[model samples]
Target chain A: MTFFEAENVSKNYAGHTALDHVSINVKEQSIFGLLGPNGAGKTTLIRIINQIIGPDTGELRIKGEKLNPDHIAQIGYLPEERGLYKKMKVGEQAMYLARLKGLSKQDAYSRLKKWFEKFEIENWWGKKVEELSKGMAQKVQFIVTVVHEPSLLIFDEPFSGFDPINAELLKQEILKLKDKGATIIFSTHNMSSVEELCDNIALIDKAKVILDGEMQSIKQEYKSNAYELKVRDLQKDINEILPSSFNLKKIRALNNCQSFVVELPGNVTSNELLSQVMPHAQVSSFEEILPTMNEIFIRKVTEAGRSK
Target chain B: MNKIFTILRREYLSRVKKKSFIIMTVLGPILMAALFVVPVYLANVSDREMKVAVLDETGLFYDAFHNSDKVEYENIYMDYATARDQFEELDYDALLHIPESALNNPNSVKLLSTSNIGLNMISDMESVIQKKLEAHRLSLSGIDKKVLEDIEVDVTINTFIYKEGEEKQNYSEISYALGLISGLLIYIFIFLYGAQVMRGVIEEKTSRIVEVIVSSVKPFQLMMGKIVGIALVGLTQFVLWVILTGLIVFTFQTINPDLFKYKSPEQQMIENKGLTPDELAVQQENLELSNDKANSLLEGIRQIQFGNILIMFLFYFIGGYLLYASLFAAIGSAVDNETDTQQFMLPVTIPLILAIISMQVVLNNPDGPVAFWMSIIPFTSPIIMMARIPFNPPVAYWEIGLSLAMLVAGFVFTTWLAARIYRTGILMYGKKASFRELFKWIRF
Candidate 1:
């Protein structure tokens, strides 16, 4: 059974629909990426799940039970709008927030110590939050959100303000938490991060989910008739030998070496094209390259825009 | 384990550690006491010395305005033009010219000074003129001046009470004083602490911390936690301040006993003016009677069944603070920002101000409908009732019980309203919300 499921959720904020009959399932121990561009109801959906705002009509089931107060204790949420007591000390503020999440003082302190040490921020305990750098404060915020070790974690742009090294470090911790059987819901526009970490992906656009499935399957579903082929330039121009049935999408050449994304007829295979083109140039490498997540994201959003 | 208690502890500790809280708490009472006492202390020592040139054309007030340390009169015959010419050079503070036959026309006399003269100086001259004029009347009458001085009235203040048995005196003066102090303190603490709650909410809301905390705890818990925390902070500071102020005042009095001395010869003369041995004796007898009456009135109040007004003061103080603090929190949360807060602040603040204004009236006449209603109103009662409790309250125990219950009920209801608004307002960004939207949010 799914750890969390929302069935036919709908919400309207002052007659403007933010979520229109949205539904999704989050399996336990899975990294489910809620992907969308700016203003795409991704945050609206996340807020509904966290119960920060109520859905107009829906049933939000957590661990096969209706979502309520007790479910909040098992879920940790890091809001996109980062907030902390600017005047309070780092550890003091963290402890207060941790307690609010239902962690006892002893348990919170013990967990904070480990998280702080692991994040190499143990020395930051005495520093006031306002005195810390943005990245440093983000680390503290990250610690507070996860200190209680909730079973379900929702992070909205959690890697924002984090440098690449720190972002990678956070990614490892998130994956480790998943390995320990925590269901994680991550929302971001960074398709690379989603591609690196997510097992399942849901793309939301204009208050509706346009696509939702396993990450690999969704990527396959959104593929275009494109491939990347790298070749040695034996013949000066490889395009001269290509049949009129083939469509050359793009080509790049440097230092007597060339690479291209080719669109072939549906009846033709890569071997047939390679056999025909081999005599024109000594092929260095030939393989079908799938589109990057960034390309797929832009394509799908543009497609949705055109459809509307 | 106890969530509310946990919130309270955190708030208490955090606020107590702040430097602003520490400074204000410890020094606030001393500063307040100084504001009251310093002026009184200064009034006694501040200059009674004002140099004056008296032109006594009538020759009647030469000795009327006798030389004293407070007013040193120097005789001068300079005309108006000459007095003006040497006004600054003559080293005179003021020139008092009583025109001829001024008693027949008191308005004809004029004072010339480089700047505005003190009212006391002008009033002193009038008083001396009136006494001399009255003395002239006595001389024309059959009685001599000495005989006229001996004629005095001895009035006694008596008290009659309708208690369980006999007619007992009431210590109305001390009771009024005690009542005023308790009531005023409650008024001040409620205002100070309630405003502190307002500022605390604004601070959190401005800092955006409310948004994050609201997601975890219910908005009601967050608002209650802040209200209770700030009250504890106020209470903690109040205790520290009481101790510190007492110590500072005790030290000042002990180390500088001369500062309090009012035994100077001028002070003695001022105390003993216009009285003979017989008149003095009569005055003393009347004073003793009034003092006895005052003391007995005090004893009557002390003997009444209420255990201690101080305890009631504390209960009503906490109750009043909680009641007002919640209202302040509600107002604080209603607006997303401070500027918008003003639109709602008036209605929230007027009740507190009214409670203070009505507190004395309640003390003077506790059994009156005004006091009874103010005490039971829940808004004014915390202060009004506390003030009147020192005075004899003619009411059943149920009134007190009912007032307390209503205060609790009022707090619970208002807290829910504040929490509902807070939950919606905290996360709302950018757009401004109206009263209609906020009221609608409560329905959700």
Candidate 2:
């Protein structure tokens, strides 16, 4: 079931359109990546979903019901510019934010205690946020965003200030949240993480969604039907042996091994290309090259830009 | 509603728990009480007796210089040079030289002292010499000095204010002081607490916590919560100040009751006397003629309606603060930092500053056109009305009712405007907002 959806949502600020007739749907218990460049309407769309802003012309639904203030309790948002009261104690600030999200005081305290312990940060609860390092404060803010166990969690650029280890830890935590049946909308410029974590993604560019689908299918749709072949025989000429249906893109020699990249025509399958190249050389390895999410993001955004 | 409470609780608790807030709350009343009591204590404690030597070469004013509680005068029989040399030996604070120019050119009288002589001593000596010279000239002109003294007449006016079919004595001095104080207190409370609200908003905005809070609660709720929370802090401080100031003033008064005593010596003497009815009546009349000045001042203080002033003072204080603080909050949200707030602050503070500047005019003519218009206008009425209320002016009930209604309306309008500016401005950064931009936010 679609846990959250925005139908033809548009937002205008001053004379500029921030979001122009954008629609997105997130499946239950899945991580939906919102990919966009700087100045795109990704943040605006996320804000609309959180109801921090109202769309100029559209409606939002949560759990197949019309959105209202009551839905705020079920949504948690961590904005791109992360913030916390610098002079406030960590535990108290967390509890206050959780209560603001509609959790009981006792429940907030108990849940925060567990989260703090799980993160091994129980000792820092009494410290002021200003005294904490940027990464530490980000962790505290991350804890605050999910402490209430909202059904839909929106994190904008959640991994920007984190180190590699902390980013891995956060990735684990996000996966754990998804396992616990929370629908997540993650927005970032980092595409590698989207490949690792996102089940589905919608690429927004220039206030419009240019590409969106399940992560596997979007990468598959952008693939060039290319394959990397490692052959031991350096004596065979790859250009002459390849059929007219296939184009040999490159042939490189590494030590005693020769590897060639071959692209198949649209009508040709990967198996056909593999079989066609097998007799030309001693094919030790044959692997189809699928495009990375990063390649797909860059290619699609540039293509959209060029088209416009 | 619950989210607003959460924000309110956070704002109040974080501020009230600050060490600075506690220190100010405790220190404010002590400083205020000291302002009232210290000057009185200093005046009483610094009264030391001074001694003067009078070298009268003319010998015409030997007995004119009399001793009082604050000064002692002794006549010296010596030349000017001998008197000057003996002045230090005599330990005199000053030496008064009455040069003989055939008792003419009174302005040429010289007073020499080792150090600066007190103005009180100089005036006293001048008056003594003038009185004796006047009597001397009167006798030489063939007119009896007693006839000139008998022609002297003292005039006094007793003021009564007739209101609601009753005669109420009016005390302009006491009421003026109370009016000035009430008006000044409201001015101070509004400025002090309004800036506090502005500073609180700036802190939250600059810290970037506003977006976090606004996401959970509406921007309007967050602004209202902060405004109300700081107002409660102001009220808490004020209540503490009133109680502490009262306690301090009461303790000081109880410890030094004589410090505030306004009784004249003649009244004290009459109370101690026992006389026949005929003598008593004559003495009583003389006492009234001699000491009515002191009694009239005390009576004037007794005639003021303190209870009425207190009630109106509190009402205007809260109303004025609410009206100004909302505007201050709006200015705070429109800026990136404190320095950027100057342009917005001037417009918001001008009306309050104008109210204070016109307080004196309102106090003088509580029923005049300026006072009437100022007291009727919502922006100025908080202070001007408090000033006028103490004077027992013939202000109609509906004027006050209308003024209060307008003040509430003003607060509501400003709060609505502030919320609009705050919602958009909180998320904006690194831009100096113009009035045009602020108005745009209001439209948005």
Going through the candidates in order, what fraction of the true interface contacts does each contain? 0.44, 0.65
lDDT tens digits, residue span B1-444, model 1: 256666777778887988988788767878966864586577566565888898777777766665555677888886767776888899998888887767578778778887877777788777877777677667777667657656855655655567787675555666677678777888889888888788778777777677567668767777788788888787777677767777777776787676665334333343555555765665566566666655665577567545566567667878888877877876676666678777677887788888787776777787889988988988888877777766643445898899888888877777777777767776776557777887877877
Candidate 2: lDDT of A163?
A: 100
Native contacts present in candidate 1, fraction: 0.44
> What lDDT does candidate 1 reach at residue B304?
56
What is the Cα-based lDDT of residue B74 in candidate 1?
83
- List, residue by residue over A172-283, the lDDT tens digit for candidate 1: 9899999999999999988889999998888888888888888888777766655677888567565678887889988887677888888888778888888888888878
Q: Best-fitting candidate, measured by lDDT?
A: 2
- As a whole number from 0 to 100, the lDDT of residue B411 in candidate 2 is 88
* Stretches of model 2 off by over 4 angstroms after superposition: A236-253, A275-280, B46-48, B86-94, B105-117, B142-144, B153-156, B263-291
Q: What are the clash counts of all predictions, listed in order?
A: 3, 0
Residue pairs of candidate 1 with colliding backbone atoms: B170-B297, B171-B297, B171-B298
Model 2 agreement with the true structure over B1-444: per-residue lDDT tens digits: 888888888888888899998999889999999998887776566457878788888889776766656677888888988888777787888888888973888876888888887776688677768888998899999977668866766687777888779987777777788878888889888988899888888888888777677678888888888888887887788888989999999999999998866545445445543445664565577787766666777777676667777778778888888888888888888888889888898888788789899888888888889988888788889989988886764468998999899989988888888888888888787788899988988998
RMSD to truth, every model: 5.7, 3.7
